[model samples]
Target: MSQTVSDFIVQRLHQWGVRHIFGYPGDGINGVFGAMNRAQGKEGEIGFVQARHEEMAAFMASAYAKFSGQLGVCIATSGPGASHLITGLYDALLDHQPVLAIVGQQARNALGGHYQQEIDLLSMFKDVAGAYVMQASSPAQVRHLIDRAVRIALARRAPTVIILPNDLQEEPYESPPRAHGTLHSGIGYSAPSIMPREADLDRAAEVLNAGKKVAMLVGAGALGATDEVIAVADRLSAGCAKALLGKAALPDDLPWVTGSIGLLGTEPSYNMMMECDTLLMVGSAFPYAEFLPKEGAARGVQIDIDAGMMSIRFPMEVGLVGDAAETLRALLPRLKPKSDGAWRQSIEADVATWWKTLDGRAHQPAAPVNPQLVAWELSPRLPDRAIITSDSGSCANWFARDLKMRRGMTASLSGGLASMGAAVPYALAAKYAHPDRPVIALVGDGAMQMNNMAELITAAKYWRSWRDPRFVVCVFNNEDLNQVTWEQRIINGDPKFEASQRIPDVSYSRFAELIGLRGIFVDTPQLLGSAWEQALASEMPVVLEVKTDPEVPPLPPHITLQQAKNFSLALLKGDPNESGMIKGAARQVLETILPGKQ
Candidate 1:
């Protein structure tokens, strides 16, 4: 029997260093699976992971790329199977991660004839991968298409697609594959550092030197330049405020480091931005322009590798288009150290007071578990090298504010898209990338039920393959969309409609057990520690379902008068859920306005 096109595709993937393929079996892609079976026992052969759905497969693939810094690959059959991969593919594209998706099409002759399970997969994926979507029209084009898709995804940090027709996949290959140079194994397709122009560097320094008070806003792009960023901040004697995505960039223990700077932010960060006369933004294109300094209130100097993102959020006085570390290094030599440390000292003092205040709130005793306390108790218990993922909702707020990310720990969230149901996939991918380390996911009941609960079975299926069985999923059973409900009350001046915002009761821990995994449930604060210990000690995947108080609102660092007015209107609307709203407001207002805590 002669080799088929599917065989060549698998060979090309092996040469490019793919170790895992996340997908589900289907008739449209039966030929590809046949080739996979034939290549068993070969060196560098890929392992197949069976997912409950194609969307979960795509999410896992994207997260694999994020944690491992490798080209993540996903496979799906034609028609609806391929359509299900769109949302997760967008997740990768929005986060700027590299992912390659291979979807099966109908037989070559039935492509446009509306045959069974037939659809134009190319046109469907055009929006996501307009530049990189290709079809293997002939057997000779199989190898080249695979190579091009992988290279484009790696170099550009974007998603690429390859459509394989069912008929062509089983055809005999007539020509030899073109020989291409081996890919570099070190950093996998990273470009050289881009240095900024001397003139732009000088102008940035001039703006900083002219100001009496300065502040630096850091983002994820500055992760590699942590040391350089600290050096520049120390030289300028500037306070550092981190964007939510940059939460783990620097240690929170740093005296001058103010925490996150948006809705899920701290008072110190908000105050630092309000007082600074000059802002130095490094590798951060943080949205929410209202949180930033108003026009003419502060002079701005921005640094980013993508020139297109320059001045997109706030107007910059000097935009230095270059790599973060290199630009900071160039600007350091021409800058002068601030003669006064008073500004930085004051900011540090405020940050210390905020921590004490947060601790007091997190430890408050209540009927049900307080969400903030969950983060507080779990933070000290995690291993130094643990990987954590958070779902978007009120749970994310607690994780952002109360959780402490040390120097060695890594955490991820959907910062740009703010999507729910990513925690399950994120944790699975992290465990696959570093099987020896612990992986945890902090999710809400509302988010857990939203297309991610089924993923628990997927985790159970792959449990035996992991070297370390320290995977934990902490479920916050709040029974409501607490984040958006609070937003409706505070932003829209609308009362919470119980029917619409409430989530039906479901025991997530029981669901875990039914899927053949360890499960623990806690309804009170006293059992929080014991539940976590049990999870860590179990030599298998565990889900800890903690019944949390939905009444405790995740308040922002600062609130305007208009927001207060909206809450008052909700109270006057005579809704039955007004007491929780009133209590949350009182707690936040009293703590912020009263001076005794300081």
Candidate 2:
């Protein structure tokens, strides 16, 4: 029997080391599904994971690439199915994760006829998969399309696309003939060792050595260079701040390692950026120039694998384009040890004070439960080597500020896109990548209602297969779009328009119970600690829901005068929950000013 183009494509993907593909099935993609069915349970065959929606599937693929450091793959049908993948693919593209999307298209003859489910997928995918996007015109083209898509996605660390016409998928496979205009592509890609020139490294070292106070910012690109980052920081007696995506790049236990940097940043981080004489940015594209050092106030040096990303955030005295770990390793020997210990001591003191302030804030009383306390309680209880994920909302503010990450623990969310509805899917993919480790996802009510609830079924379907059955999704049931609501007050000077801010309160815990998963609900702060314990110990997947107060502000590290005025203006304009908002904000502010005072 002759192998169909779909069969050849599947086999070729496995050859290129694709272990799993996430997507929803459709008639347009039935040919590939048929091929997958035939290849199932065979030696070296690829596994397929069916997601509730194509969007979630793409999110899972993006996260799989992030957590596993492998080429992530997703598939969908033509038109809507293909279009549903755009947002998630953008998440991968912006975050610099390598993902490949394969979608089925209409029959060749029906493409221009405007048949059902026929849309111009090529133009739709052009931006997200701009690194490489192609359609297989003939059976012979399938081989190279698969090869190039996989190779380029890995090489460029971005998303790639392949559009397969249904009719061509069932046709007999053919290899490119050994003739002119025919190309033969092979499987496998190895990242080459990249290093900056010696002259560049020497210049960076000189700038660092001259400065009395040095500050470092690390991002997702620095994940693999943890030890190198530490060595450089120690040599220069510099303090380090982590971008949200690089939270796990350094352990929070380090005194000088300030937590997340930006609006969700720590006071110590903001202060370090404001006060430092020299700045070194490693592998981070943390946008928000306001959170960085003032223009021309500090000498800057940057290291990144992508030349385009170098020196974009802040003008630098030197920009080195190379792998983070490799470049840092080369720069380390050239750096002269700084004798000044005063700057390091000051940073450590500020970091210590910030943690204490956070503790006071987390312990402050709310209407029922303080949102910060939920994360604060979980911080000490998180098992060693656990993986954590969070959605974008007020929940993320706590996740960024309160969660104390230890060495060996991995965590990630939709970094670049900062999209909602990604936490559950990210957790699912984390479990697939490391089935033996426990995975937890922190979500808000808004994101849970948006699309995460449906993914709980996906969890129920696959939890028992995991070697470790401790997957917990902790939902913050605040009954409001708390993040954006605050943004309205602080950024827009508008009151919380109840019509848009209020969300229907649903029993996320009960929903989990209906699907054969454990459910625990906590309405009081005292129960928060034990609830986490119960959820983490459950053999089945669990949903831990906390009835948190939406009025509690996700306060910025350093609120600007304009933000203060805007917040006051919103209150003057008559917010619906004006009393609770005042109380919550006051309690949080007082905790910072008068620590431990009720």
Candidate 3:
């Protein structure tokens, strides 16, 4: 059978389980877009999404990957369109996401000449992709390259680029596929191996028997194995806390869950993990070596499915390469309870005390509204199975601390390398993939502006399709880098820094109304409840724009004491010439933290 270069690329994507592709049509890639359209109509496994910009297309693809645990696919034309995609691709790379980016190139014969939009794409994207490729002049190499690209993307957890020359896209090809990859259920996040060697279980049991004060620190890897993890924690009578990703694994409201660890991680979580005599690391390989306590004789039992990662980031005394849940289960039976265990109660009390202080840390009557109130307010309206998407920045850590995710409700993110404009598209994918479930987006004004706000239209389309409309997009209108500004006050001596000074005003409410979505704008915390009430009850996609102070403190990932001091200095040295912003911040913070005094 004869197939065009475009058809070959589209077909290969189907073979690799990619469904939705985001792209903008350009002259350089007209051939590929046509092929994509034909495949969508006939084959129908993959679908096309027209994007306003190249960056949005890549952002959508990256978010889709995290949501589905599959490689996300995006397309763009060569030259400017291709060039515009670099930022989004960088986002995908830094965040460790799997994405396949198809870009157009000048015709094969016109490569070296000064073509209108010629760029050294392969060389430019060398650092950005997990793998890179140029279109083959012949049909045979195209097939091989496509296979290699997908493998590299999935294996390395980064984006891959395939720049197609205009002529190659027009060429004809035919063949049966050479090979397909098989799944090894024992590895990766979804199908965690439950069976561990008896020796490992025995070792864990011995550790529990010897340790008087043990703490179990679970990470995202521990998800799906929550029950198993808890069972092990119970067996050891160990105090339990989580890494940020682990937030989805266990119920945050659970009395047994101590708190989350690391930067922006709760104080209760930090103290317990730091003070424990023996720490059991599960599912998560937290890269911050300094966040963990230095063990003398106290040891760590690290368990993960990825064998290579057992001690890749943190030193461990006993490295168990298997599923966290499975290893815990096997180990639980072999271990006897330790005598004179003081860690669990003491840690639990400390954690509870920290929770009490969180009221002071996050909540207070503020005129512009506290960011924490956004999540705390949004949670009650969402159904138990809602899917929440978070952007990086103050919103990311704020939502993490504020949102209470039940097991079925997923909180998807780009982890340590937080990307700002990913939430809207990610939420769109979740709504598309799980039509029955509700999806909410917690975004910052700065973040939402970057996504072009066209996502509202998509949400409206989704809402009309389902008899029950259950999507909400909430934008916290804090027109600054509130997180960074908090540090500026302490370190730079400038209490207020307008990090978002260049951003234009966003009348998100009016924009949502223009796009057929329900728009509810609130400037105060009190108004949030009513806005949320109406938003939750709306028959279509709803948008809640909350006017928040642009000077909130950051929800940091764990920072060193020295780093804290440096941040304080940044606040002290903050440009005093920007005193208006400083006063604005101090007022906002005072309003939220201390009322009636001023």
**Pick by lDDT: which candidate is best?**
2
- In model 1, the runs with Cα more than 4 Å from the true position are 174-190, 594-598
lDDT of 3 by residue, 418-519 (tens): 666777877776765666777788888877776748766656554666645777888888766555555555444444544434367688988999977778
Give RMSD (Å) of candidate 1 vs. truth: 3.0
Q: Is candidate 1 or candidate 2 better by lDDT?
A: 2
lDDT of 2 at 113: 94
lDDT of each: 0.84, 0.94, 0.72
User: lDDT per residue, candidate 2, 1-598, as tens digits?
Assistant: 8899999988998888888999998988889989889899886588888899999999999999999999999999988999999999999999999999999999998989979999999999999999999988998778888989998999999999999999999999989999998889888899998888899999999999999999999999999999999999999999999999999999999999988999888999999999999999999999999999999999999999999898889999999999999999899989889987999999999999999999999999887999999999999999999999999988999999999999999999999899999999999999989999999999999999999999999999988899999999999998999999999999999999999999998999999999989899999899899999998999999999999999899999998999999999999999899999999989988888899987
Off by over 4 Å in 3: 131-134, 176-205, 295-298, 326-330, 339-341, 360-362, 452-454, 457-468, 491-495, 498-504, 555-598
What TM-score do all the candidates reach, one by one?
A: 0.94, 0.99, 0.86
Q: Which residue pairs of candidate 2 clash?
A: none
The residue pairs that clash in candidate 1, if any, are none
TM-score winner among the candidates?
2
What's the lDDT for residue 455 in model 3? 66
Models sorted by lDDT, best on top: 2, 1, 3
